[model samples]
Target: MQDDLVRRAVEDGDQDAIRAFLADICSLTDMGFAAVARVTEDRWIACQVLDKIEFGLTPGGELAVATTICNEIREHGHAVVFDDASAEPDWRTHPIPILYGFKSYASFPIFLSNGDFYGTLCAIDPARRRIATPQVIATLRAYAAQIATLLEVRSPPTA
Candidate 1:
C-alpha cells in the first residue's frame, strides 16, 4: 500500500514543485536533508529527498516505521521538532536521534485533501538548528498542504 503511494508521489506530475519545496526548505532551515516520506502502518519510504549531508537515503528508500518520528507525527497529528537532540534532556536518549546521529530534526505530517493521511515532510541535520517557531511551523504546514493537494489532484482516493 505504501509502495503504491510512494510510487505515485515520486512520479506525480508536480514532482518538480515538490522537489523545489524540499530544496527551499533545506535552504531556509539550514537543514542538510529534507524528504517527503510515505508513512504506512509499519513502514516509512522516501518518496522525495533533498540530501546535502549525505544521510544516504534515496527516493524509494525504506526505513522501519518504528525507527522514525514520522510515525509518531502521523499518529498524533503534530509536528515533532528538536532544536538539538543532543542538548535536549528529554530527547537526548531518544532512539531516533541516537540511531540516526542527528542533533536537530523536525517532521510535519502530510494529509490528502480528503483528510486521508499521506506521509510527512521531514528534515534533519547534524548541527543544532533552531526551528519550531511559529513562522517555521506555518511554512512547513503550508508546504505539506501544497504537497497534499498535488497528490490529491494527481490521484484521489479510490472510491
Candidate 2:
C-alpha cells in the first residue's frame, strides 16, 4: 500500500503515535480533515491523515505543492488560520479554497529540530467555523513541535 511507503518515509520509529497525534488534532480542533504532509519544493504527499468529511485523500495522496495552501506555509514558515474563507474578503476568491471546497482551513509549518522545513500539519472543514481560537492555535503549534520531535527521533539530518 502507498501508506506503507509514506509511513516508512516519515516513521522509522513510532507510527501509531504519529497517527494518534493527527487524530488528536482533528478532535481538538473540531476539524473534519487533518493531515501531516511531507512537502518538498515540488511535491506534497500526505504522510498521515484523519479525514472524516470525505475529502478523498489517503495517507499517500499527493496534491500539487504549488496549488496547496501548505505550500504557502512551507515557503513562509508560518501558520495560517482561516475561520471561513467565504467570509474573508482576502480569501473569497483565493484559488485554493475554491479549488478544494473548504471554507475553514488552517495549516502550520512542520520543521525539523535542525530548523529545516519538513512539511505541514493542516486541517480543513467545509462548514464555516471558528478555528482561530487561542487554544486551538496553541494545540496545533504544539503538535507541529511534536511532529518535528518524531522526525528527529526517526532520523536526524546529517550535518
Report the number of the highest-TM-score candidate: 1
- Per-model TM-score, in order, reads 0.91, 0.90
Model 2: per-residue Cα lDDT over 32-120, one tens digit each: 99888888888888877888999998767789888999998888899999899988998999999999999999899988867888889
lDDT of 1 by residue, 64-117 (tens): 899999998889988888789988887898888999999989889898766778
- lDDT of all predictions: 0.85, 0.84
Q: Which model scores highest in lDDT?
A: 1
> How far does residue 4 in candidate 2 sit from its true spot (Å)?
12
Question: Stretches of candidate 2 above 4 Å error?
Answer: 1-14
TM accuracy, model 1: 0.91
Model 1, which residues run further than 4 Å from truth?
1-6
Total clashes in model 2, counting residue pairs 3 or more apart in sequence or in different chains: 0
